[model samples]
Target: MMNHSMSAATNVMKTVIYIVCIFFAVLSIFPFWIMFMNATRGTFEIQQNSIAFFPSTHLISNFKILTGKSFNPLVGFMNSMLISSGATFCAVYFSSLTAFALVAYSWKMRQPFFTFIMAVLMIPAQVSGIGFYQFMYRIGWTNSLWPLILPAIASPAVVFFMRQYLLATLSLDVVNSARIDGSGEFATFNRIILPIMKPAMATQAIFSFVFSWNELFRPLILLTDNEKYTMPIMVSLLRGDIYKTEYGSVYLGLSLTVLPLFIIYFLLSKYIIEGVALGSIKE
Candidate 1:
């Protein structure tokens, strides 16, 4: 009788947990569903009723209105893709390399250097924006994507995360073994360490990509040409005037802008779970 009561209690607990999960899941997805539904409805319909439960037939019309504006979704998409991909690659690869150095070597200034990086991390990016913009302006890189892409190499946050991940997972015995086997440092890192760090790298890559894609401040301040504007910039521009704003078109642009983020998140989500789980375990 005790065992039966315990089993019943466990089953009831699981059912309650499942119900809570489903409720939160619906809450999470509700906004995106409304946004897509609004994207399909007419502007007047959206103004009349913002919370749309069903899709309408105004998708093509909304696209037409969105395209009538100065912004080109295709161009914005391409520019964002280029910047985000370059930034993600540089951030992940260089951060991983820096983390490897910090973990695998016994340099004298290792702790101090790591401390300096932590200091830099504490200093917010907005604090350095003016100095950064001035330097970029002096070098004539303000209008170019180079300013956005190259700065990612020194991402203190990514470096910090990678360092912690390496400390949790890296083994110095493996490094010594590779060194004894006549493997060059670069070769060992590229061939052995990178594969081991794949889960962490993928997780960080997703974050970096999403950050770059959604970035608006630097691009808005630096990019003078509409041709170089990212998706966020274009989407922001879609709201020209509050009174004349086409709600349907704006929602459509937002839905389009967010599509790639969803794709990136889905592609790398598995690695995120693995990276978090592995980072939590200490061997």
Candidate 2:
């Protein structure tokens, strides 16, 4: 009966793993439940009683208070949209361009150039924050959205990720064949390889969008004007005395800010994760 014992042991292990997974899932969902409950209760209602589980009824009122006339949450959302989209578009295009150039070229110093790019990728974003701020300020771009837009045109993370994927996926024979077929360099990239790089591009686009959308420190420092405030900025503005702090409104604002990211992840998360995993695994 050793075989029977072994099967029983395997079943026990499987059951244990499944139970552990369920526990973790519940743990992860607990915060989201709390946030939703908080969003659906008045700032004072929560203080009055200990109500747990699904929220009662206060989402619409909370949203109204959070999106007040003075704050104009919609304006903030629009600003974030413009900035994030601009940054994502620029970052993806240039990263792809850099990847293609590094892969297709055969210069004497190609290896060294690539090594430098890789080195840049290793540096943290904060390391360059001071320099970037100063550079923007000196150029009279500090108060405008252009500073945010300009910095994203050259993303080291995008370049490195794209380079790794291109080295794996892109074929030299395709480039040579394109050249032989009277396709110009620009035409070859624009027409041929770009479509194939969709997985990587989509991944980068989602990343850049999220990064820009959630960015607070840079925008806080650079964008001093209230008119150009992004979602993060607007979220930060929800602060006051202990009693005056609108926790319900804050929760509503948080949920509103999170909706776009949720949409993006919902749409592209599977392919993005697959692309990254495949690229890393093969490498």
Candidate 3:
């Protein structure tokens, strides 16, 4: 009788957990659904009951007005892609090298350097936001993609993330074995460590790419030339001249911007999940 009662309780708990999970999942996805629905209907129609839940036929017409050669969204998309991709590449490369140095090598200042890096990581990069803007303006890079790409190369979060992952997944014994086999630190990292870190690096790559791609504030203030605008900047400026808001085109723009991230997450979800799990668990 006791065993049967316990079994029933366990099953009840499992069902409750499942229900809670589904509730949160729906909560998370509700915004995306709303955004998509809002994109389909005219702004006025969004307030309507039935139309709010259904797809409207204005999507194609809205898309034309959005990409209508005059307000070229493609240009912004291209710029954002270049800047984000380039930044991700550099961030991964440099951060891996730094993490390897901090982990594999024993030096007097190693702990201090790590501490400093962590401190920098703790403070929001936006603390010096004003100074950075002034400096960029002084240089010719204010109206360029360099402003978007350069700051991320020295990302503190990347450094911290790689450091934590290296400590957790990478054993000193394996690294030393590679060294004993006459491998230089850089070569060991490139051939051995990099392969092992593929999952973590992939995770970081997605984050860096998405954050950079969706970034608006930095690009908005820095780049004045319409030709050099990033995706978010272009989309934000897509507000209607005649209408107060073009709900369809705005939703379309959002969909286009988010589509790449969705594809990337879908394809590499297993790797990203593994990487995050491994990195978060301390050995």
Clashing pairs in 1: none
Superposition TM-score, candidate 2 onto the true structure: 0.89
Please list the residue runs of candidate 1 whose C-alpha ends up more than 4 Å from where it truly belongs after superposition.
1-24, 242-245, 270-283
Task: Give residue 46's lDDT in candidate 1 (0 to 100).
Answer: 88
Model 1, position 144: C-alpha lDDT score: 94
Write model 3 residue lDDT over 1-283, tens digit each, in one string: 9999999999999999999999999898787887777677665576454236667877777778667733566787789889999999988888888888888789999999988987787676577778888988888678878777777768777877888878878888998898789998778889998988776688888878887888877887788898898878776665646324566677777777777777888898887777667656644
Write down the TM-score for model 3: 0.82
The segments of candidate 3 whose C-alpha lies over 4 angstroms from its true place after superposition are 1-15, 41-54, 69-71, 168-193, 239-245, 275-283
- Cα lDDT tens digits for candidate 1, 1-283: 9999999999999999999999999999999999889999998898888998999999999999888877589989988999999999999999999999899999999999998997888676678788888988999987799888988999888888898888889989999999999999999999999999987887888778888998888888888788898998887787678426688888888899899877766777787677567545534
Pick the lDDT winner. 1
lDDT of 2 by residue, 94-198 (tens): 889888998888989888977887678667667778988898899898778888887787887788888887888998999999999999999999899899788
Whole-model lDDT values for every prediction: 0.87, 0.81, 0.78
Residue pairs in steric clash, candidate 3? Answer: none
Which candidate number has the best TM-score?
2
Error of 3 at 119 (Å): 1.2
- Best-to-worst order by TM-score is 2, 1, 3
